[model samples]
Target: MMATIVKGGSFVIDSSSWESIMTPEDLSEEQTLIAEAAEHFIENEVLPHDGELEKLDYKLTVQLIRKAGELGLLGVDVPEKYGGLGLDKVSSTLISEKLAKGSSFALSVGAHVGIGTLPIVFFGTPEQKRKYLPDLADGSKIAAYCLTEPSSGSDALGARATAKLSDDRTHYVLNGAKQFITNAGFADVFIVYAKIDGKHFSAFIVERTMEGVSIGPEEKKMGIKGSSTCPLILDQVKVPVDNLLGEPGKGHVIAFNILNIGRFKLGAGCVGAAKDAISLSAAYANERTQFGKPISSFPLIGEKLADMNIATFVLESMVYRTAGLIDAVLQNIDHGSDAAGVQSAKGIAEYALECSINKVFGTEALDFVADEGVQIHGGYGFIQEYKIERIYRDSRINRIFEGTNEINRLLITGTLLKKAMKGELPLMEHAQSVQESMLEPTEQSDTDERFAQEKRLLATAKQIFLLVGGQAVQTYGLELEEQQEVLARLSDMMIAIYAMESALLRAEKITAKSGEKRGELASIMTSVYVHDTFASIERAAKQSVAAMASGDLLSLQLSVLRKWTRHTPPDTIRLKRQVAEKVKAAERYVVV
Candidate 1:
């Protein structure tokens, strides 16, 4: 496909290959050992016990999770002072990936650590942290977040649960039921949100031992059965005033922000599962013969493998970039109790759009990858014995939980528009700066060629946003959910473009030091990323713009958009094979 060009900017092609950009990072001995330890634990401890745990045996589930905590895997992202390893987000994501190889057992651990405990670490009071977090961090006690009720799934503020302050003012009387809570049977601590005064919400840290607190029988789910999921019944339970998580009427803050972190971790897990799915398909294709030869040798199978690799790569790139952005925001700040910590909220709040974007993309991408994985395996993929079968079922919840992807789509668009309105996004500034930085071309190779393509795609995407986003917001407004979908597509186009731009820029800098071979490969991958991403943006822009139109302009613009089909990327099959080979060789998902 021919490349699209920006009017005021152009790509400076440097001769280099993706190999330079794709060079692996050097890990410290500790990092390597930690990852290996996680892998070993999953293969040995978790996989063997998957059957019994899947039956909802609370005792066995808690024991295994505690064992994981003992291995220091549960507290990888927790601070040292809080009984955690205080590792970086990438490392935590790696741990998540490894645990995912264990299937739902990984999910069990994730529930206890990621969504369940992160809120306390990020937003709890000193007393609350000291009271509940220590046990949670050490795995002595499990934790669960209670947000979804019988009626409140995505519309959290629509919750009917009530927590009325007692006449004595010492405790709050809670009367509500939270359904489909993970770690329900095992959690000793629950972060429950309840309405106060009929107009406001509050978060309360309730213990299982509290009076009138009970757990319902486990609900049989479509997947992730190993993780206990049941209802938390709180009938006139007495929660002390001290147990209130944050100030009254501020529970939405905790619910929304902690959920952002959960979405990222969920995306990371999807990446891990996608890798496994891809590997399974690739290996099966190589071994299983069809048409008198291995299926892997055929273009059809090759295309599927390529598509899987590209999807995985895009997701990993986006996930890590989002993580790195969040890490940057949370880096110097202390994530302890104390209201002073809230003063630094600007950092994390700024990236809400990015977080939601990753959630939507990662979940949807994994779903696509899983479906394709099954298709690649043909009938074998559908059978229960095949891990893909389980993975396909397990993957469905990611979109539903942590805010349904439908809600997340609204968030992605709303957040982006909000940011843009507030001047936080500066999409134009980002575009201009990237173009300026690449004005002077360096050298040339295969990787450099790819880098050039990535730039072209990004530049085109920026243009589309400038033209389309403004038109939609002015015409459709926020009330129309379809506009939100359009905004989501626009944001995705920008995100993919940004990822490619960043990776290409990094690859160029890396190549300058690593030599041409590595540089060439990085460039190739960058181009591959750009090509795939641009095509997506082009399609979305065309569809969205046409949908927004009321008159003949719709058909006219679509026809024009179709005429520009020369802008798509290279054969994805070959590009994905290259990506898969790297993933298999490293046994992990990575961009480089």
Candidate 2:
């Protein structure tokens, strides 16, 4: 396998080695302790208040966030010099995953710890970090991210929010209404994005106490009602020149990079929520009875539970794998440096492609799990009395958060193409190689080695991705960028390649360290998910090919596709039943 420095978006072109990647089984003593502490915080301090939290009680939400600060949960990413633990990226991601058990409270804390405070943590000047980080790290203050305006949702740069230099250059007058600002109700500080002189994009630290800073009433929502969502009104607010974040025109850098982090953490939160859904559903299935026995005894019910476990297992593998990659990059940064914030953002920007994929896949996966959970609960699932009902509603917002799944899907393919154009990834070269190799005779694999079959299919999936992507580019050339349908189908293929490979690496690594029996469950889960997802990969490839060509050209492409997808799929039914048994026994999503 080709192994070197792991570049962002390189998975599409290069083979991945499990040796350098992190799996759930690789958690360190310290990282495990961090996970336990976060779990305890969510269980003890956060969950007990769900009744009040569900009532839209902003005061209690503030108190709960403050408690998280006291527990040192808020400061994992903050440097120790600034009253934070400054834990590695894995620890922070672990914290995000664990806190998600509390539903709406997770959103509140996620917004604060992620987008809210990260701007200063990553891009703020020294004086700014010294002045603001201590409280943010400790949860004495809450932060909100202000970017989405009423009219500018996806087109963030088209913001009408304006800031101007005051006479004597003492302060900048800021004016704009930011819509859907999370944690806005009680956020003590805001990381506000506005245009300087209505042209230069920039970010500012706007304190709630500052004159002309006001928050609108919370908008009623479909779910996560406990989390605060409101509009931020900045009317002639006076912000000192020193409070500007990063450079004036480079605000887009801070905004976009911070979003990459947000997208990743959001994926982490979704993983936690999915596990909760599975556990709750499993418990219900075991206890609920119908047709003379427990629902858990029925094959159909077991099938649903099996599907959820498989999806979540793959998503969890990908999330932890990405966190490990970021941690590798973060190890090289010196948090004491003035440019540490900028350095942190730059290091994370490399994995923007993975982060977006995680966001898109993890969210949709959670939504699927949540919906299935509700169905398993029957009529009770729809009623408010059941927690799964809340979980189902809360899951819907994730697809729209960070960036809408639609927008992220486009970015996923767009980012890869841009990288290829800039020569950051060898995508075109790999595509060219795969095309030439297709002209050679096909080879069959009958090796008895462990995971040999899974590896072969994974390799074929990657080739299919590159093939379809190359054809789309050649057919459309510069215009391919505008073909959203083709771009989206190609994005689905890219996603399957990453998901399949991530699951395989984790499974193979686990089996290598532990005995085959100990790692058996993981191996089976990987096989099932890979087999199912590979079929999806084929469908996406053929769909795009049909759209791109016709006649003999289409037939030729179809022949190539058949050669790529000719591997025998494993017996998924048997594998899924095995997975369901383990999940049922544990009453939760499980991997050996």
Candidate 3:
């Protein structure tokens, strides 16, 4: 039965199955070389122009992108026939991670390659690919995606942008405005979404030379100022009928599928940026002295460094695990086939729940990491002269990028329910199993002593999710959407579960290969993460159950939660101190 369920590609409800998933430790030599090349490019080409790029020098930004293109960085996921490197998802994730250290320059490159060009790569006609991909892949032509309107942000399909067919039916007259358009100021190609006849929501490929298309002045932003961000205006712009992307009335397909990929890539980029923050903070703590001693020696400062590194490790593990799953699905896809684009989209969409989880978790984790990075720099953290200050500012937008973290959180639970309803995931069945287990007698679980406690805690965490989530669904039915707070709590529980599982699996894999001697840090980090995360899950589950039920029912549910959550709390103070010693000694993040 489990094998049959596994073949269906549903969510892995069983904890034992997670070990089969790939981890960052599984990256092949070729993939590591690609990652190294990306790091070298950023260090040599991007960091040197940091100031010029931040000043909004669009020309310098364009030149740097072309340089990256020359090195095949822009086309990691594109098919070779389309002038791209045609690498797997892991390779693409690696490039995104490495380039993240470049700050605003990374945003520029990411937007162009992700939302801007991917729509064409995955949904455009054969002629469209032949015409635009070569230039996009090689960075000769820049691209931007136009989706958001003043009236519609997260409600994407509510866009007011309209397209009317010309008398000859040979062209579309586009009229509307797209706000906060990334790469808008200098993009040669634009993937614009508009409704045709005021009803059929669709996407169109509009070029810069179009007569009625114009770009607004660059909007000054609190962060990511170096990346061109402007409103794109379309006043009776003439787009060829053939320029329609995907099928008419199916623009949501392109919009959503592209956004799915965008969300995961954004998560990967956040992990990279967080790693940079960890390194910067550790180095600063080591050199900055307080009270005649290095700050890194202080327990409080060491605590901060340890927390930052722990979060980074968890995030890195989640991102690569997701990338590996995406690649596994894509491996069976025939890239040369006509259905390749649609098939690839389906492959990615299969993990929509996990992708949303990654997006929300990774961004929020980076925000915490960046805030600490700034704090570790002391008063210098507040000034622009310090790199941590800029990183702090730059990190703010990620929460709102690729759909706001709030929206992503909502999507996380929403997607899971939809899958459950469609029989794609056995969420309800797993919930029932958890309930049954709760009713059974508690037994002394015999397991691997090394991770036995953490593993049991993980299982209980899943039970908490099932108990609270299952009750929420029963109480509200479809109206659960109105219970935003409950939904958010469930989402947090799910996020913690995913993070803990990823960390545990990664640490287990490492320990199995290198033994306790070399994998000691990994084990410590995993234990620390799971211990804290389990507490958080317990809190979220209690809050959610209380809100959903009251009086005796609430008391009963809370009792069950306490039973499941009971565990010997690891000495996190000592664990963090130990983790921090290594971080301070290495002067950077060493556990990765």
Candidate 4:
């Protein structure tokens, strides 16, 4: 075993004690317009047809997507030059989230617009763009990305499907299959990746009209059943020479780059779904009575509601932050340049940690929030007629499809560490201040005691990230093959910490100008969040450290476990009421 040793003296100031910069802001004018427009389309078009869609009416689903296109929702991310609305990444995310209020319909629409069509829009040649993008942007044609094989779920690049190049190399004969493909049953254009020459991979724009292309019966799923998912079969599917996307032997780039965009969009969708779930939970809690009173009146139920709101708030902030970062990168790419934003890769790469972090944290957070929503409802949550049940079911796939949380965890931790090792992060001035205040902690505010612990854990985590992340890159050569899981965990923790910090920071701002009530909520929530995060981060750090260290592994594990237990704080049933009331008053998830 090659044990990696990291010097412990490399210090990052535990600045989590400082106020956070992450918080959910009101949508900008354009974002509000886009969100409302999407909401209107979903309410008017999708909700009314739920009965038809439940029967697996493909025609109805197709019609609805077309209507979405007509409303310009489909083209939200496309440029105006290509018949799209030419919206930025934030707009797309906002639209996706708002549409998610419609549940499965939101997913169906997201699938058609995001994974189905974005690759061609971003990486396609002008002729290719002219050929496919217009239909995709107009929602006249549906799209799908075929990369997952039965044997290769998250290991997409290791797909077994093969495509053979002809003797003239003018065209390729594709022979392979893609399984569990979203929108497989109805997509007009398929972005299929296959191994060529037995080693290199290539991407092709395979159409449904192709001679040897077919879709198997839809696979029954736990949720999102209304959105078609099935196997895409290619039996000697003869693809045209011009159908090739990007260069030969470079399909991995196309697959991964597009996937990066897909994951980010998927994160946006989760944020939307999370918001919807919280809304549903709050409404249900406010109405449904138990023990002769509205369930929302109970402290435990109130806490659950508060948790749901806070989790959603975290997701929204992180999703938009990621959108802002990705937008800056995509916009900086000169349209006239043939470089295809390769030089601007650092922009996306800079947030790779954030993207995967959001993917894991946001999805899992929503899952927990939704589950609690169902729990609070008691029996109605499980009934088929209730939307919460469907939302719960639909939410399950979000964590699984867009790179399982397991895979995402690795990417998150690995990316954070790698970035640190590469010295890409500019160092902030190191400082620490401890102030003892008797002020009660608020719902989203950080208590000094709790904040201090988080600061220490984050500082240590950054060190571990650099140590393990640097060694992994050096040994494994930056593909993140072996170090993915560790990276993912690290990334998840970072996102949670970031979200918690953001909420706390925002609460502080509100409290400073406002009265004690707001400040109290902020302080209490902050205490709970910061302390909880401190414990979680410490656990993850200890695990990663143990994985890299050469000491008595069992002893290290027990020490970390004991450390966590010793630091854990008492349960806050009282503090939760403050969080619940604020969220209820706002009628949605408000940062404070």
Best by lDDT: 2
The regions of model 3 sitting more than 4 angstroms off are 1-12, 16-19, 444-448
lDDT of 1: 0.71
Best by TM-score: 2
Q: By TM-score, how accurate is candidate 3? A: 0.97
CA lDDT, every prediction? 0.71, 0.91, 0.89, 0.69
Ranking by lDDT: 2, 3, 1, 4
Worst 10 residues of 2 by lDDT: 1-10
Tens-place lDDT per residue, model 3, 442-477, is: 654546688899988887888788888889988999
lDDT at 94, model 3: 95
Question: What TM-score, over all chains together, does every model reach?
Answer: 0.86, 0.98, 0.97, 0.83
All predictions: root-mean-square deviation over Cα? 6.2, 1.6, 2.0, 7.1
Give candidate 4's error at residue 590 in angstroms. Answer: 3.7
Which residues of candidate 4, in runs, are more than 4 Å off? 1-26, 335-346, 420-489, 505-527, 544-571, 584-588
lDDT by residue (tens digit), candidate 1, 128-241? 766776678778998888999999889898888898899999999999899999888788989898998666888888899999999999888898877788899999999999
Residue-level lDDT for 293 in candidate 3: 93
Write candidate 4's Cα lDDT for 1-592 as tens digits. Answer: 2212111112232333222232335347888788888888878878888867866678888888898888899997665667787676778888878787776667777777876777776677778877888899888999888989989988888888888888888778999889988788788999999988667788889999999999999998888878888999999888988998878888887776666667777877888777777777888788887779887778788888888876676567567756755666567566544344343343465566566667777778878988998998789999988888988988888788778878777665555455456664432112111111112231233356534554444444454334334444444565656665556555655665666555555555556556556566666666566666666766665666566555575465445335333444646666667788876666566555
The clash count for each model shown is 30, 1, 0, 23
lDDT of 4 at 517: 66
